[model samples]
Target chain A: DDEVITHAHGAGGGQMTELVDAVAVSQFADAAADVGLAALDDGSVQPIDDDHSVVVTTDSHVVTPLFFRGGDIGRLAVSGTVNDLAMMGATEPLALTSSLIIEAGTPQTTVERVTESMREACEEAGATVTTGDTKVMGSGEMDTLAINTTGVAVVPKGGHVPDAGLSVGDRLIVSGTVGDHGISLLSEREGFDFGGDLESDVQPVNDLVRAAMDAGEVTAMKDPTRGGLATVLNEMASKADVGIDVEERSVPVSGPVSSAGEVLGIEPFDVACEGVVVMGVASEDAADVLDALRDNPKGEDAAIVGEVVDDHTGQVVLDTGFGRRYLSPPEGEQLPRIC
Target chain B: DDEVITHAHGAGGGQMTELVDAVAVSQFADAAADVGLAALDDGSVQPIDDDHSVVVTTDSHVVTPLFFRGGDIGRLAVSGTVNDLAMMGATEPLALTSSLIIEAGTPQTTVERVTESMREACEEAGATVTTGDTKVMGSGEMDTLAINTTGVAVVPKGGHVPDAGLSVGDRLIVSGTVGDHGISLLSEREGFDFGGDLESDVQPVNDLVRAAMDAGEVTAMKDPTRGGLATVLNEMASKADVGIDVEERSVPVSGPVSSAGEVLGIEPFDVACEGVVVMGVASEDAADVLDALRDNPKGEDAAIVGEVVDDHTGQVVLDTGFGRRYLSPPEGEQLPRIC
Candidate 1:
């Protein structure tokens, strides 16, 4: 490992994995959790009783610019944790804790805007901000603001989904278009206007996921946030010790996002999508799940983009109609503070 | 409100109270919690079942220098949340989530040291760091590091304590000496040689609190952190709509801390004490609680500081033998980034 931390170490890539394992997992090896630090899943699960278990996840949002076209840091802070809980099959969060660290000179209006955004997002997700802490740092000691939210949800014991539960014949379903968030933020930050259509798809997707789960069995689930579709597929394949075969053309990408990615020399599939979920559904119920997801407005572009396979275990193969190649996890962050 | 946030808005005093009430409490007005954002207590409680309730609390640590005398940011981060849960009568935390945001150029060794300290603190508190998130900001965009920790504990329904549960005849007891943490850090930062005895009292006091709870009936509880003992006393008095009368000489102040505070022109009651707890116990149980606290090494300096009164509602009076005065909440941050 390098002597000093770098941007890549927090980019949700191979480097970040190594860093987390070495620094956190190794130190917290004795955590008495069913799916704890060692699992590196969307959240940790602790059985509270014979019939119920508690699910928890935390994320610190340090997104630059604070506000973008579609959402602000406050919305991102709440949705990020909510989606993580939803990934573990805990769709309805019991509560969310918000801790804000603001720079000394940040405008009071900015704080109000962020709080209002968080409230609206909580309303949208059917969750509440129950408790929070606030602190302000010296002017140059911190950036504009950073919001850390921790979400708690309870599910029936043995009922929560895991990212490594995929079977050989499972089908992979994507909730919506890929790479909209990362691409949109990149375009906006670089002063490249791809018109109003190129805006972040940063909204809570727990309701969309609830619909999908209600329709059929979701064998494995994950949201493509920091590392996008390619990274998530690779993670699922490797974790389950199975192979994934994806039809590249089946993956939906908005026209504006596709154009913007090309102009920025970035791959839509290699970026992030805040309001998206990639799930491995049982083969028998794939069609019903797809239909259920498509019925929701947030998942109107839902598609069956891939399938779990036995051959080429621990790898993700992308079929582009003319050829096939193994997709890899992203190496480093493409756009810093795009969350 | 000022156009921009200043240091006073986060000093855990009058200004900070106004900011939190205006921004967070107003936005999260609909939180369906037993003790939610509106109460502004140490944590929030949600009933999980007929016999059990869930307690949750969060704190974001942005201390300067990262490493202080007796503790670093790591110990403070874990202990802060753990103690908050303990103050709510949830002595045994099931799990804690850590979210670290570091500057791009910080040394990995610094992170490892902090993680190690956190592990030790968790062990002392009988808790676990079950899940976490890490992110890096651009160099110069942030200080060395900031840690946000959220704790979750389950207790019997209606068993938790609130800061507003004080009664007219209740007795107030402090677990240890005051002004150690804040004064130590101030001296260290200003390059004053205060000697090793003046170091921070920053260890987790959950065990000590547990002993007291087992020995007596505690009506109200609070940890003196940012705005210190005076702030906690005032908050308790105002929230419970009662008065508090304190014998100034009875409040324990170690020789070193007393001397340092005198030289620095700061009142011990107005500064932070990370490892101390001020509890309002039934008058009959005051002696037993004090004895139980004194049995623990961390609480060896325990003393009966005050008692609740019916007169002067929502105010705290200090009896100095020669004269009497009202103890006011610290006006602004005495020191920035002191955690």
Candidate 2:
């Protein structure tokens, strides 16, 4: 294969999958743990004890324009890892380790600002940054900085969500508005002037997720990040071996994101959402989960947007109210560093 | 202070301290776990249960020339983290998380080779790469690749070693030859032709560390990596508040490394050794520990080169047969990415 890594390969799309499958995943297939590399979920789950397990997740944030409207890379680095743990049904996060590769000559003020934001995010998520590593590369060896956070969270052994736990009768609920993060970054990159309350939805969603988990049992959860809502749903479908029937109208999108998508020739559903979580729950408990999520500030716009079906396993179908269509895996990175 | 991050900041030396103290250390000062940010040891120890605690460590490997004579970044990434765990007296490692950032257009072959090496390293260390994250930057955003590995290990509550555990009468023993890793990378960068059996000592030292640990209780342990033996010994002296008296002739340095050091104008004591360990042990048990370490292939050159002294606390003095002198903290990174 003449495959090469590109911006699209980092875009959390099909090409990214190809790169991972061809180069990275198989190497770790044989070294299985409680949740090894073979499991393509948001995080890795390791059994710490017979009755409890530790949910570990790591993400490297390379968002361009380190400082964005709603948040900065520090906040994203913390919330990103925390949210991954939450997606694995961890309500209590333990410790986080940050590995920072910084570009030399970067202003000290920028690093301080980012660290302050990260501190705040960690406080919000009720976790501590206990351990970290920092390396400075010569100027141009890197853009500004890239942070990789590895978080550990403890969960009840049998009471956590699984990526492949979705059932035929499960209802899919989206925590909040999608595409805000993607559009915000895209606009920032293109230097767009049409900005009306378009900010990256980049904040810790553990509190809101906990509320939903308390309201009802969650079969599975995924935070739509680089790949967007469509890609995440497809992943859930494939992992669970079930069909995801998404109602296009029910998928929440803010007015700014909708307008920006139209201007950028992109679909609102295909843009990333940093704080949004797509969760699958029992059909009978979906309403309670939605209600619980809506009560939390972070999940105010929560909605039941889809359902798991028996037909078309490993695929996602969109119901456009006018007509139905198949939602294919993202071809390439529509927006890099969407976070 | 109009301080800025420089290549020296990442060199694990004096400037690195200024940067870490000003930017990184303060942020994590109050976030204390079993072995938190305040202790600049190899890994952070977290108290999970009353009987056993979890040891966690993370390191970012930005070694240049990804493919080296002895090992690649993948192996270094895994072995580095696992070694950190072993330094904390973790005979059994639990899990590892790898975060990789690759430059766009990097050959898939390179990625495969590195990943394969990482898998082998994991196997050798008896740990699993259970979780990982991948990100690709544009062609110029990175210089090939950088890997960050965060590892987890379980240790008996009271059986672990501490950075400040050295006692006044404790002897310092270094496992294997020093400066191999540093000299190799430096020679490669300087294009030195003095290549007589010069290879990086960048293999896992867990077996040697374990052998020594089983032989006797270790007071303190450190892998002489970024800033090499002098920096790590200085850290111990400061932390343990004990003076270190090192015998210059007793410090083991391979012939190739000694030649390379002389040519590069670098001190053997200051050059990093990726696979070597410096340990503080009771004088009575030093011989037993040395015997055990020498039995292992990784520690065949084990030597007791120093001892903790009650005088001149927080300092390291080198006795060069006729006279003694101070070994100050490294001024800067002599060779960058000399992992």
Candidate 3:
């Protein structure tokens, strides 16, 4: 491990995994939890009784530009936790707790805007901000503001999904276009104009997930956030000890995002998509799941992008029509504070 | 409201209340919850079924000086959330989620020490760190580190206690000394040598609280963090629409803390106490509660500091031997990042 922490250690990549495993998982290995720190899943599950389990997830949002093109820190904070719970198959959150640490001199209007945005996001997800804490630091002691949200939801004891539940016969589906959030934020921060609409796809997709679950089985699920589609595919593959074969043409990327990624010298697959979910469905139910996802406006661009296979276990093979190549998990910090 | 936020807005005082009400409570006012954001309690309660309700709380730990005299940020983070759940009458935590936002370039050793401390605190509380998120900010973009911990617990329906449950004839009790945490940290930070074993009382007090609850009826409960005992007393008084009369001599302040408070010109009552609980118990059960608390090493300094009254409603009157005066909630930022 590196003697000092760096950007890579929190980039949701290989280094992040190493750091988490060395520090947290190793220390908390003995905790008795149904789906705990060791799983490295989107959330943790604790069976409350024989009938139901409690699913909880948390995220700290430190996006540099508090307000971006399509969302602000408030929306991002609420959606991030809500989506994490949804990924664990707890689509309807019971409650959400928000904790804000603001730097002195931040405008009251900024805080108000962020709070309103969070409320709107919660409404969209059918969740509520039930409790919260707020603290202010000296001006130079912190960046403008950071919001951390923790969400709790209850699901049937055996109904919750895990990122490691994929099998060789499962089909992979994506909720929407990829790379919009990271690329859009980067372009906005760097003063770039991609010409076409390049707004972040940072919205809560728990409803979309619910529709898909209602229509078909989702054996495994994960939100493509910090490390984008490539990272999630690799994680799902490696954790399940299966190979993921992705069709490059089937992975949707908007014109503006693709062009912006090209100009910024970043890969759409390696960046991030805040509102997307990469789900593994049973082969027999993939079409129904895809249909259900596409029926919602948030998932209009959803696609059946890949399938799990036995060969090349623990790797992701991307078929780009011309040739095939391995899709590796993102390695370092591609963009900081893009959450 | 101030056009721009200031340190007072996060000081757990009058300004902080205005900020939270204006920004969070009003925005989340319509959310349906058993003990929602409007209550401004230590935690919130959501009825999951006819028989069970879930309690959740979150706190963003931005305490400076990652390592303090008796506790570090890790222990503080876990204890803060655990105590919050305990205040809501949920003594056994079901799970805790930790979110770490670290500054780039922080030493790995520092992170390791903090993680270890957190594990120890969890073990003390009989809780587990089930899920978490890690993010890194650019070196100068954030302070060394900030940890946000969210705790969840389930209690039987109608079992949770509220901060506003106090009534006339209730006796107020302090589980331990008042100012150890805040005074110790200030002396350590400023190089003051108040060398009579001054150390932070930052430990999980769920077990202590459990013993108190098991012995007597605790009508209201709160931990004295931030604005400390004075602030919590004011909040409880105002919320419950009652007055509290405190015997100043009865509020326990250790010899070292008292000397430090005198030299530093800070009121021990106005600062923080991380491991102390201020409880309002029915008069008939006060002795039993005090006895139960004293049986625990952590609460050996427990004292019957005050009593609820009908006069001076929404106020806390202190009988300081020769003079009686109002004990106002601490104003402005007496201490920043103390918790």
Q: How well is candidate 1 docked (DockQ)?
A: 0.77
TM-score of the second chain of model 2 compared to its true counterpart: 0.97
Q: What interface RMSD does candidate 1 have?
A: 1.4
Strongest candidate by DockQ = 1
Query: Would candidate 1 be rated incorrect, acceptable, medium or high by CAPRI criteria?
Result: medium
Q: Write the per-residue lDDT of candidate 2 for residues B115-233, one digit (tens) a residue.
A: 89998998888887777788888889898898988988777887788878999999999998998888887787778768457888888878888889889869999988888899999
User: lDDT tens digits, residues B1-339, model 1?
Assistant: 558988998889998989898778889865656788899999999987788889999999999779989999999999999999999999999989999999988989899999999999999999999899999999999999999999999999999999999999999999999999999988888888767778889988889999999999999999999999999999999999999999999999999889998888888888888899999999999999999999999999999989999999999999988898998888976778888
Clashing pairs in 2: none
Measured by lDDT, the strongest candidate is: 3
Candidate 1 chain A, which ten residues in sequence have the lowest lDDT sum? A29-38
Tens-place lDDT digits, model 3, residues B1-339 = 459998888889988889898888888755656788899999999899999999999999999899989999999999999999999999999999989999999998899999999999999999989999999999888999999999999999998989999999999999999999999999999898776489999999999999999999999999999999999999999999999999999999999999999999888999999999999999999999999999999999999999999999999999999999999998987898887
Which CAPRI quality tier does the interface of model 3 achieve?
A: medium
True-vs-predicted CA distance for residue A326, candidate 3, Å: 0.7
- Candidates in order have lDDT scores of 0.92, 0.84, 0.92
Q: What are the RMSDs of all candidates, in order?
A: 1.0, 1.4, 1.1
* Interface RMSD values for all candidates: 1.4, 1.7, 1.5
TM-score of each: 0.99, 0.98, 0.99
The Cα error of candidate 2 at residue B190, in Å, is: 1.2
